[model samples]
Target: MSNQHFLTLQDIAPQDLDALIDRAITLKAAHRAGEASPQFPGSVMAMIFAKSSTRTRVSFEAGMAQMGGHAMFLSPGDTQLGRGEPIEDSARVISSMVDIVMIRTFGHDIVERFAANSSVPVINALTDDFHPCQLLADMQTYREHRGSIRGKTVCWLGDGNNMCHSYINAARQFDFKLHIACPEGFEPRADLLENNSDRVRVFHEAQSAVEGCSLLVTDVWASMGQEEEQARRAAAMAPFQLNATLLAAAEPDALYMHCLPAHRGEEISAELMDSPATIIWDEAENRLHAQKALIEYLLKTA
Candidate 1:
């Protein structure tokens, strides 16, 4: 099988993207049924994390274990790459040992440069510009709750951070419309917002963007490495919170999703977040199944 890199949603064709989500749902059911579904027995995945995380680390490591594979945890302090060694050299050396690699880092270029030199499949666990892995779990959760997201409308609330960026790419890959409601200075990448203008729309008001939408999603007001700006961001994004009022305007069965580590009463309201109707927990758990399917897809094809 040829080496494939999952750096972004565009890396996979639309049909294959849908296939992966369906496979993830199947894997979840099979696991719950206690059926044998080992696809990567004894495989090794090198997880390189330059940034800190709770969901990303736990989900990937747990997913590898469930698939009969080993996952190595590497921090900046644990490897030479953290000490200023070039990523190209590290990528060449690490790829030779591991069957697959996962990187959660600060910049998008780091993953791009590493994949260019690696001989094995590389997955972008998370990057400042895109969190494609989270999107995988999110899309899988949406598929499990609703049906296909094709032609449906999804609304995103909060800062135009990595999650927002991934949603933009998902709009194109999943054949859906995305309405992003963010403050003026917090909008997503210019090229992305412009390149997919027909599929994506940017709004400043949450109510205006979410009305009649089928799904609503949000993330923290201040992501990691941006703690100092939390106060200011809270003030600017206060008016865009996802509360019951916004939900009332959305479709009756519209589901709410958050990529875990949510800050209640900030980007989203506590009342809605704690409500039994929220699918955030399912979205979080899908990270394990979706990533297992992803690892299987990459290694089986490799």
Candidate 2:
């Protein structure tokens, strides 16, 4: 939590990272039990989003507000950075005014620069390469329903995007067996594959990926700005859909997960998302709790 940056999962030590996760779980339970307080009184968080979002925006804003902190939204076109101000300058300026800075942007380097120059804690809301916050909520969800993440099997059935990258990173720190099922061209990055190959088990087949798995996860087949290829992506990812047949291949109690704003019949079936085993609402609710813990962890260090 020290040294002033949250550039990537690699920035956090494994043990400390686990401690944060444990804290998140505890915080989530406390909040649900109506025992948690708005600990961030009079604090402020600034959100710089070069990319658009619905859940990320609402979750962070509402989470901070619930913790007695206010969030200021700054979109790319609405800010001076869009007019050619150096990112470092914007980072330094924002750090001076806020208790914490959250950024959802295009490249990883943009977030890295912000964290590097900022004095306050830098939180990655999302980026082209990693989605640490989302993963935090995800880990909390697993802990809630599944008891423990260690020694469990997590099956990812979609493109190896930022979410998949963070999941693989988490797998390395925790003891979960990860099974990634992506189409040939849609596989996770090679370097990520190599780094976590020893820690996780990868699969090209959805059946093999979900077999005996404790959890099944997926994301949008086509992410934002990739709308041009929606048809192509849908075609490529159709066979991997989370329908009843595929869900049956996993553990009988296997839970379903998706980073929200799911395409109803595209990536997951409506029935599965509304099923008894679905914990997505819990997952969605935990986004607030997980971020509250993350903010507390970083602010405590300060």
Q: What are the Cα lDDT values of the candidates? A: 0.92, 0.85
Q: What's the distance in Å from true for residue 189, model 2?
A: 0.9
> Counting only residues 3 or more apart in sequence or on different chains, how many pairs clash (N, Cα, C under 3 Å) in candidate 1?
1
Per-residue lDDT of model 1, residues 1-302, tens digit only: 24799999989998998999999999999999998775679899999999988988998998898888899999999899979999999999999999999999999999999999899999999988999999999999988888988999999998999999999999999999999999989999999999999999999988889987999998999998999999999999998888899888999999888897888878888998899888899999999999998999999887
Q: What tens-digit string does per-residue lDDT give for candidate 2 at 1-302?
A: 24456666666787877788888888777777888478889999998888888888898898888788899999879989999999999988888999999999988999888787888999888888899888888888888777778888888888889999988988887778899988889988889888788767667678877898888899999887789999999998888888788889999988889988898899999888778867888888888878888888888887
Cα shift from native, residue 47, model 2 (Å): 0.9
Point to the candidate with the largest lDDT: 1
lDDT, model 1: 0.92
TM-score of predicted model 1? 0.98
RMSD, candidate 2, Å? 1.7
Best by TM-score: 1
Candidate 2 residue 159 Cα shift, in angstroms, is 0.6
